[model samples]
Target: MRPTFLPSLIVLAALLLCGCDAPVDHYPPNELYSLVVSTREMVSTQVAADDTTAVVEAWFGTPVQPRWPADQMSGSAAKALVRLDNLERAAGRVYADQDDLHFGLYNEHCVTCHGVSGGGNGPASLLQNPYPRDFRAGVFKWKSTARNARPTRDDLIKILQHGAAGSAMPTFRLIPEQDLEALVDYVIFLSVRGQFERELISGAVQELEYDEARPSDGLSLMSIVGGDEESEALSFARETLDRITDGWARADDAVIQVPPETVADAASIQRGREWFHSPKALCSGCHGQDGDHPLALQTNYDDWTTEFTSRIGITPSDREAVRPFRSAGALRPRIIVPRKLSDGVFRGGDDPQTVYRRLVTGIDGTPMPAVNVSDQPSATGLTSDQIWDIVHYVRSLGESE
Candidate 1:
């Protein structure tokens, strides 16, 4: 069965009956909506095929057709997909209530903008100024975990609860908690799937000489022909899946726990200012003197500009709001300019805990990196106290403004 927006509408009606206030309509454009519906049809057909293996192949298969003679669903690749799909199915059964709603929750609400494969290339993606997130790359802009780690579940949930301040992504706070959990699970599923697919493609292209032009390359698994190669390929696939899944599973374990609240006083603020200017943190490098200014041309591009401009036919000359998604398609490609910290408006909330998470997680997809400090001793990292001092300093920048 195909999914519909009626569930959202139903929720809206219930809200009205209860006198609860909430956003009734968060629908995307008709073109994007149609695209999602069609994509679901394709998925349903693939899943409904008599051969279950075909479902695995189609869902996890590479976008690039291999040119070489290859088994597209090699034994090892098949094993990996089977395992991952099991988890996906389990997540679906446990989190999502129905079949049609499985991954499409993320697809309709997210994929319409974030992309079916999480590559941030949804039909409407290019229209937005800051293009939607490309989950395939596994780089989230807002996180509360350590470097190169998955965003903590709470981190993902928080973003859903409170949407990003300057983006097209809306807050899903009003959705039932179960629905929210299902969506988050599906998103993580897509992220892991996309990342693994990337790894498999890279491995096949590099090691197996995947070529699409070869007659034997049609839907064949990237199988290993020799004994040594087979063992190596199987080992490699297992290791890759482990690493990818483990990174996500371990995110919560690595969350940066802030120490109890402390007063943002003169001494702490002074210390923070010093840290900001220090070569280690390099706050002054981009956010020059008092966070209001940058020292250079500041050409840093956000993920949107880096990935979508050329695809959408946007050019350097198009500066003002020239995109449809932004300013109703009137604005130009939006630049992901670094925030003016001195302005005192924190897009990710100004609360102390939020500030600490940003410092630790280093806003996922953006250029802003997490501070190199921990509560424990490290020759290279900072202690929690040090980060607190810096946080105080940043907070002060807004106050002084």
Candidate 2:
């Protein structure tokens, strides 16, 4: 039973279609999930009336009056994750105070495309071929970490310094370092907040009894266990918060360590070419032979689209099946075709080390896969040396003929 937000979106759409009101130029209180839903689990929870908003609000506070969850996260933990001052600067609408000093850095520069809560549904979002990156998933594409690992802080800073190639994300290199730091901190804040919401919803689905007291009674997810600081519910909430924050704290340790580049001798390049098309490599499956000659180019969806569509059994190509969703505020599906390797434009940086990392971890949220490697002495998979050959072969493909 998925929660349907169709009615609300329908009303909004009708208002627009009938020209009943002026265009929506500003979005107030860009709370996550206010415009577009975040996860299917969230949808299901809403239907069951098992929503976790009150609990999440209790932990993170409302968009207007944001809280820092100091009881569970403070001092060093808070510092490592995000600075309160920086986050506050980036959190709200663009404005000034008594001295007219600028606040709401995020809203000033990012909200039009990233939405208030970083849901990637900002007013200008759908106009782009690929919508802006949604930070809530806590999964970033151009990162140094291995599969499913949290992105290191440096990984984020680098992205800000150099905008993601082949996308509408422009570089903020000219901005002051402090502003960049604030934006990055705000991104982490939105990501952590989104993940926290999903985790709480998931936990409630698994453990919450239908008869449990609701938030109106002052007993929601966090205080539901016994309504006290020493209660089991509070402990569970604290542990969950700690787990999420600890992962971010440990992001540096999870980066893939790439071996030095294998010299691109003819033989090495030849072996790499063979491995590129090898049955086991599977590179040719989506990216065709020699990197871009598929029998017929097929449409592919990134992880964000997969989250709500194919993952939930809604076929992406079936228009009739998808119209309701779009009308209800889901963005129109955009095909993310496999990159033509021959183009030689690597969005995740073209350097050997970066490419090497991409090969080892694969591109997050795409069809690209990490090469299989044999870690065990007797295990059967591509060894590190073999992967290096493939890397060389890939780099060679980009070289001018």
lDDT of 2 at 255: 90
Q: After superposition, how far is residue 140 of candidate 1 from its true place, in Å?
A: 1.7
Residue lDDT tens for model 2, 295-358: 3334578887766577767777888877766764567777787777877767778787898788
**Residue 5 in candidate 2, Cα distance off native in Å:** 37
For candidate 1, write residues 1-401 as lDDT tens digits. 23668788898989787542221122222222122222332322111121212222444442221111123333343233223332333231113446533433453366557654556666676677567776766777677666677787777878888887766778888766766775676567667665655555444334433333211322223332222344544455556666776677667787766677677899999988988888768777777887888543335555444433433444523555234333322223444566778878665667888798788777766667767775585656777777888899999887875
Candidate 1 local Cα displacement, residue 203, angstroms: 0.8
C-alpha lDDT score of every prediction, in listed order: 0.56, 0.70
The TM-scores of all predictions, comma-separated, are: 0.62, 0.80
Which candidate tops lDDT? 2
Instruction: Tell me the spans in candidate 2 whose CA falls farther than 4 Å from its real position.
Output: 1-44, 47-51, 62-65, 74-79, 95-102, 210-219, 222-227, 230-232, 294-299, 375-380
Report clash pairs, candidate 2: none
